[model samples]
Target: MASAPQTQSLPLFYKELIPLSRQDHAKYKMRPPETAPFLANVHAVPVTVEEFPMVQRRMPIVFSVGDDAVPLALMGLNEGVNLFVDDEGKLTDNTVYLPAYIRRYPFLLARLQPESEELSLCFDPSVDWIGEFDDGEALFTDGEPSEFTKQIMQFNEQFEQAGQRTAQFVKDLREMDLLMDGEVSIQPEGAPQPFIYRGFQMINEDKLREMRGDQLRKIVQNGMLPLIYAHLMSLSLMRDLFGEQMRSGKMPQPDAGV
Candidate 1:
């Protein structure tokens, strides 16, 4: 759910990546897409530690399964469903906090070559946001990046930094052996069986509580305890999300299984 994209493996919502350059795209302009059709069917999106406070309030915060367990904001409990966004990819609730991972779509900082130490601003060519359009923000000014382009580059750079910090946070959790397979069961009225959801990882609350005083203090000092608590608090929202799905008639039949 939170696999990092490599050169050989394209990232989610991106069909083809092309390095942004003045020579190749001097006439290109950027305009926001009318609707994000790419997000219509995506359920889980990778999130960073920096976004925990806001993200937790809006959606359940869980970790993806596997060795590279990254925090994921559960937009929907099941795959190919997003309760927050409608079929057009527009948010059903305008106030919902959109994850940075989604906001940074179509543009990212990527290494041009596998062996290169430097990263370049790259974008998905398939997106309609960037093109040689008559009406949009210019990508270049006098053969150099325009202010808009520079701002985009800056945002992607910050995202990369946040990603690194998030990686460290996950590493710390793994070192403390605090991650465990997560499960959530929801029983609706008159349902014969509860809907059981699995295939995700979450913090082991028991292990966290059992940690030595010194270790606890260390985490508190490092500002991880609050983030952990935020994640724990967000779990309750899973039911709220399930309810939304049910109300929208998006929930599958009980026998279908999640």
Candidate 2:
């Protein structure tokens, strides 16, 4: 595997680098009108587990991003991704599982959405475990145990399964980078584990998009988000180098083989 070169640079302005606005760019044409390849066959399903047996919850394995809001499509444990729920009903982990698809090609967590069409992204950050509540079943109501307890059990199962599901996705993600193929040597007994994804790379992509509205358009044209994450820039000079690439499709593809 080829390693990325180290860089030491100063910061630059966003406006100065990726100077091309949507009105002036052409490669910003990656999508047709209605193409949501992210949510193909997934749908929400009940997840029943002992840990959260009295909660009502569903896990979304797939996603459909549009102008209004994206929807999650969660399939069965064997069929699709899982919804990660903390023991306390709070969301501790979340992501998709791609056992086979990612083994062959690189999947960029990118700004692939087009403004002209009703677009959906491949990721979201709004769904997280919000902690647990004993929804009336733990205590009898009107001198009777709530029948809804079964539904609650189903909800908790979904969340627990989601965690198992997300764990696999993180595994698949590490497989995409160059270092993931190496031997497992870095460790210490009982020490806090290091994360597979970190900092900006682990950011809620949906939140990043929400924060960067028009700026994303230019970032797409420049194709700089992934570059920066690969440590190819200083926060200051990102847009300038990104802008140069946007003006010309001659940007070099970094050799980040898995």
Candidate 3:
């Protein structure tokens, strides 16, 4: 019920996050989201385990190398570059599947208190599309959440559930030592040199091949084997992405980090 401008670390596009309070924001309304300009600069986005099959079809699914080791759908090959998004924040290929993480933008669940385990639905108040308005979907009606707000709450709740499963997926991968430093290289036809990309992590196929039969059966029964194969197959698309970069003449120059 309280407004929090600086509560916790928000995702890439969020500016000011505030808990949705009917008491203080009874009249605020949300305009339909368009273009998703906030996502323009994001090169990668976290994806849930359930989304691996769909996401892997459109982009390479890699793991962020760290203790967290979250799954990320890479939208670009280099840092701060998103090949899928255009200058206006619109997707370049409409046929490409969009990640739920991006579709649930501006609205997300957050823990208001750092020490508390309970989370509350929160939104970025600074988003231009949300404000006190005479028209558009109302956030609340008669001091209670409206149907629109209820739907957003439902979506965020599902997102939270997906996050839990994603965490478990990472834990399983880590326990099996399936994650390892990854590198990819692409050579354009008739080009003198190939472009090499790094700074990410991928499944260790060698370790996967060496797993015990019981372990492999367990992973297969859990529906993780397909996800693993999807991620492995998606790596081939990295060259396709490089092709797009080449066509756009935005191939990044070789740098120390790369």
Please name the candidate that would achieve the greatest lDDT relative to the true structure.
1
**lDDT of model 1 at residue 137?**
93
Tens-place lDDT digits, model 2, residues 114-135: 2333211111212111112322
Cα-based RMSD of candidate 3: 1.7
Candidate numbers, best lDDT first, in rank order: 1, 3, 2
The Cα error of candidate 1 at residue 177, in Å, is 0.5
Ranking by TM-score: 1, 3, 2
Error of 3 at 138 (Å): 0.9
Q: Give the runs in model 3 whose Cα sits over 4 Å from its true position.
A: 1-8, 255-258
lDDT of each: 0.88, 0.26, 0.84
Candidate 3 residue-wise lDDT, 142-216, digit = tens: 989999999999999999999998899889998999999988877768868777778788999999999999999
Residue 254 shift from truth in candidate 2, angstroms: 30
Q: Model 2 Cα displacement at 62 (Å)?
A: 16
- My TM-score estimates for the predictions, one after another, are 0.95, 0.20, 0.94
Q: Which of the two, 1 or 3, has more lDDT?
A: 1
